[model samples]
Target: MNRLLLYVHFNKEDSLSTHVIFQLQALRTIYSKIILISNSHLDRVSLDKLPYDIFLQRNNKGFDFAAWADGMRMVGFDELKEFDSVTIMNDTTFGPIFDFASVVDRMDSSESDFWGITNNRAHSADIGGQLRPLKEHIQSYFITFQQRVVAHLSFQYFWENVQSYDDVNQVILNYETAVTNYFIQEGFKYGVQFDTVSEDISNMQNSDFSIFGVKKLLEYRIPFVKIKAFIHNAEKPEINTIFDEIVSSSDYPSHLIVDHMTFADYPDRDYLLSQKTLDFSSLKGSRTRVGIHLHISCEDEIESFLSSFDQYLDNYDLYLTTSLEEVVASFDKKVKEVILVDRGINAILAWQKIQDRLVGYQIAGHFEESSFSDAIDSLLKPAKKIVAYATINEKIGLVVSDLTVSTRTEPIDEDSMWPYMAQLWNMIYPHNEKNLKKQDIYVRSATASFWYRPKALEKILSIDLNALVIQDLSAMATITHSFSNLLTYVAWANGFDFRFSQPHLLTGFEVRRRFESRPFLMVEEPAILQLKSSKAKRIIGYTIKRLKTIVKKLKY
Candidate 1:
């Protein structure tokens, strides 16, 4: 009896993705018979050069199911039943990402007759056996079948009845969801790498080894991770920091990941080449694919801000006080797009001019010339209608969960000119019963720059900017600060909500339940946390000196 692995690989670009190539190296470890089933329209000459057995098929648009079924057809049922165990896998993920062989080795000895790498309760269909079970549906990315289960009459018929569909939902309903339900009805008990379905998601039990759990990152406990999860806040520093730490401790090449990302462009010349020539032209992967357009109100220190981002992309549609213009020749692989407001008018007006232009983009943000590269990453990670600020401050309240805490980073008094501005702010948002608290509404920073979907600001932008006049103030707080401070409120007034960029640094919700007197740590960027957590104290001495007061006040 032997073990076999059938890998289903496809891409719309007519070539295998770099992520697939990385998975192949690990596949060789556990499978006695390794086969690749490709539906991508790749060059035959290049495909013929691959080391493993290959089955090229027509692109039926059924997702992974079509590839797997066609590949199994190549390996007749007689041959499939001969193997002691079988695993059906696909290129939809980026692992046995960490020692996948070990995961297979453990499952080889598992008590259950069949099992999947993990299970998820999400995306329930609720139609009884027709849909996935309420408790769990063994995830289909990589599932193993013992010989006893493989030889079952039902197993063969499952594939015989399997269908392919152009509609994505129909495909999932037919294959991914159908397989798990079929298995459970056949009286087979299943297990998962991470049992988070029963455990609390916040705590790292067994280091939380599911494919997508952020906690499992500490141990690389789970072998495969769905590559698409990296798009949002799923790429948390707290999670990836553990993975990077593991990589740093090992002899493995970090460039493998760096290179895999570069080759992710798909349809590259070296798609099937065993030996890839790294692009020496750029020391790092290009940031062209990872991007967000920055709309800066005409502010000084623009050069300083440009230097802080990963790439200095000058691509923008500039809007002047009188008209709009595009900055040409600024477009390159490094930039997605850039928009500039030439007139040194107020920030809100600049945001208004570009509101319509930003309709199509899913993620975009507003920035003062005051953000760092790391802050940009944090801002872009959350789901839609998200208002992620650069950092959290405690000037508002002791509890982190309390959203109505004071945002006053500075003081205002009866005689202060800001007090008069507060009166004006009250006049604008005034409803005698639900009056906007002048203090809690203002953010910790005097500046109001945030990242959110462009459409969220449509209601606020509709207000006539021309009717408003900025009166010069003798006080330190001016009209600019008052207008900028309304950002959070504007978001709340709309249907959006926000989370602080670094909740781990402050009193976590669990900790906030207790009345501890630790001063709130008000950090402005993710880079500051890196510096604060640095083992090399001397490296961040200057930054440390400036932050001591902020950190000390919180602890005392």
Candidate 2:
């Protein structure tokens, strides 16, 4: 078949990723002609590497639909009719996990006017704070149009009228969802490569098949896997199973997925840790050298902290930083060295003092004395597992205490620190404007305690302390909260994954289970989520409000 492929792509970095390159290389086998339309800047070097017949680099105003429209126009309506098939796709997925040629050959025999890889069921969308009903449509990520459909006047009219929208929901409501239905309403038959109706209905209704049934799709030999399956459906433990299946079932490079996960803009900090969590019990007997930087701003928790370190000190080197002279004699293990600094300097600056010593270990951990107020023992609870995981995987640049995962309900006060952190981020990554959306993606532990590689800290450590500007914070705590967020950002930005570690016994799930098993667990839930999820509660709440109104009326 003479197939024309229109591939739309965009990224914050404005460069081609290895996975995208891999997809294009595979696609070249099935596509007779391929046009690469990018809504972002791509330098000559990047343009030269793509396996495309033509490349269109345009300003990133609209999303994928606008790019596809431009691509169709560039091909010209007359030229599109010549091809047996035309496929419109985007870079939001990682594949061909299955053979593309087989998929194309199978779909070629079908008599449908147009088809897509998957069908999105009817669902409600919140557009401008108003819930709007969206009709079921063929997913926009991968849709192939037969020549008959492409030659239709309605198809040409649809492409010609396609334009940019200020809101993506507007684009989806008008274009992505409308395109499939538009063709069907014009008396053109449409089909999907994998029909969900014949298979499980539960996975299809009110949920995305690309996300919820991705593993099943791959098992059914669907060519591509959506990236959102890993990020969005992280609560499901089966995501890891999908990753393992991809490695065992296909010749696709697994490292490319890992690379994307490490560097991509994650949905939030919770997904980051959940997707990249390492099994603590499985990793044992690691020979990697580990160093601990214990910064003691206060001596109150010194005894408890050192007591917990007794088991770990035999295998790890321990360095102490404190202002008090008497606190030096409190360790059971031989202290490698002691550095004396003023009490209020904090972990950020104190680590700056020990940069020379940082290079000696494969795994370096930073623990603040102030961070461990009464919970000092819990700080080092997962130290061994953390070091073991870091040793086994070179990609892990940082592993922080799992406090962020546990206390996620309580938000960080980034408002006060925003002015300083924003300036710091811009200074570090001036070219990447996505850095300005700091609070949205900020993932940091309240306690600045984390295990990291020496190289991950190089970017932040390179900047002098005098460069940061802050207001209304103690002279000592100026960089504490902001620097915590920046620390994780720099780690992931430099092609290193950050993980969260908690004691095996005290997992977030276990803690939640302990609370939930109690009678009063509903009190812990947010009122809005509680009322929405429970019909009985909503009725009871209504009854109470009605009774209160009656009582007030009677009293009057």
Candidate 3:
């Protein structure tokens, strides 16, 4: 009589229950006796559904490796001596009807050949060649599904020789690999039914039903089988639609109805706004203050502002008013203030109210007349006293210039190429006393070239200057002045003087020679040259002497 034993190992609950059920139902007609080998902790509901004849075990062994090998040994070829062959499987596998019969025939005909099966073609080469089947092998066992009698003898043979319980289990992988190699080395005939249709029970939705009837047979070696199965499926339309709606609603707050903005719907906004208020409370009475007002229309610009601001954490008392929560979250803990308003009417209305209270005039919708004059007047009263400006327009120059001129006792020497050092001084000290009869005391300097600002910095900051010059200049002026105040405060706290002074534009050679004591002949040589017909050398020599005399007077 011919009989068969099917073996399976299952790990997770979902696959253990639903997936394994489908495979068991499919295999019930072919194999004589079905055996399930698994861990004890499986869900009871899933376990109770199996047929009465199914063999079950609670593998309580300390090492899973040892238990698996012991489980194979317990299959007992002696009890099933009446059977002609047997089959082995894993929880993740499901085979076509012919798989069992074909594998058993191959083993019977080959006479003592070991057999293995796989659904992946890639694994065939791996098992045969580089895997050196005897060396590197996989322990996730799936082998013959065939006549019970011969299969029982092979399983019995494997069990008796099992050495160290752990090593025995581990050796299963090597055994499969070794058996594959043995076939090639000894010229033993091996057969693979690449056409066998088997679905990986692990993959449910896209089960491979094509090779459901063919079985791969190897005489002494394990045959590999390949099949395509679906592990993951694309999102269904309902879920995708809901996801898109949520994203759109969250991004366009102004378009959302007020009722839709409830805490349940917009949890992230609620959390961020609460955090902003808490942060604002921490800075109620700070001595010096810093604030960022981002009015950019694009998300990238807002992010860039926040990123650039983060680098100056130690230098500012930072505040932010923007729609970009991601950018704000990146700021340091000391940046303890922010105001949240929507990008539409709420932002404009809030600003209008602020302007009215501080500047004394309302911004009428009309652009024609000075309906907003009172607002500007009110703003000037408070703003003039406190606000300073800084700009990212030519940030490197501005930073380098600030570092240089703001140092009182130790002036930056001329060799430094801090960006816009010259321009920054011109802005900070608009009235150059040397050139001015009286200080002009301008509030802001005229806009100048930032051509030398690093392209890398500019890209990182995302500063766009393509708008009208006047508007761009005003915005940059506001930013630069605000930044300067922060810089001055930081500098002053560090024991460095923060007052601006005019930069020395003198060349290195001229600076060194300015105070050198020239011989009387050296001074007179230029005079003698002036008397001669040579104009160029005379001009240079005379200018050098005059500069030296000026230096001497300044020292005195």
Question: Which candidate comes out best when scored by TM-score?
Answer: 2
How many residue pairs clash (N, CA or C atoms closer than 3 angstroms) in each of the candidate models, in the order given?
Answer: 12, 0, 47
lDDT of 1 by residue, 119-230 (tens): 7664445343465433356767778888888899888888766677777677666677667778779987677666556545554322123434643543435666564433
lDDT of 1 at 76: 88
Per-residue alpha-carbon lDDT of candidate 2 for residues 1-556, written as tens digits (9 for 90 to 100)? 8999999989877867878888998999999999999998888888777899999988887799889999989989999999999999999999998777877887777888899898877778777788988777888999999999888899899999998876888897899888988998999888888876445657442457787788778878788889887777654546656776786688888767766765675423332333444546676645456788888766687666766676554476778887777666654345777788766566777776776687678888787776654224334655666777787777778876544213323323445677778767777778873454544335565356778887877777667653342343354354655766787777766767777554433444554564476532223445434343333343343333323323333443
Candidate 2 residue-wise lDDT at 252: 80
**Candidate 1, which segments miss by more than 4 Å at Cα?**
45-49, 122-135, 202-212, 217-220, 234-246, 249-253, 259-556
Angstrom error of the Cα, residue 419, model 2: value is 18
- Identify the superior model by TM-score, candidate 2 or candidate 3: 2
Model 3 lDDT at residue 551? 48
- Model 3 root mean square deviation, Cα atoms: 28.5
Residue 470 Cα positional deviation in candidate 2, in Å, after optimal superposition: 16
lDDT of 3 at 86: 54
Please give the CA lDDT of all the candidate structures: 0.49, 0.71, 0.32
Which digits, one per residue and each the tens of the lDDT, describe model 3 over residues 1-556? 2545455454532324333554565556655666666655556676776642555565444233334455545665555554554555555332331245465555456544334443222133332234422332222345442333234444455445544434433444444344344333544333333322243434322222222211112221222211211111111222222222332333322112211221112211211111111111112221223332223233454444444444422223333444556545654253444444454322222222222222211111100011122222212122211122112111111111111111122111121222233343344335642121111111111111011112212221222121212354544433333322223222222222111111233344555564353432333444444443433443334334334433433553
Residue 210 displacement (Å), model 3? 14
Which candidate number maximizes lDDT? 2
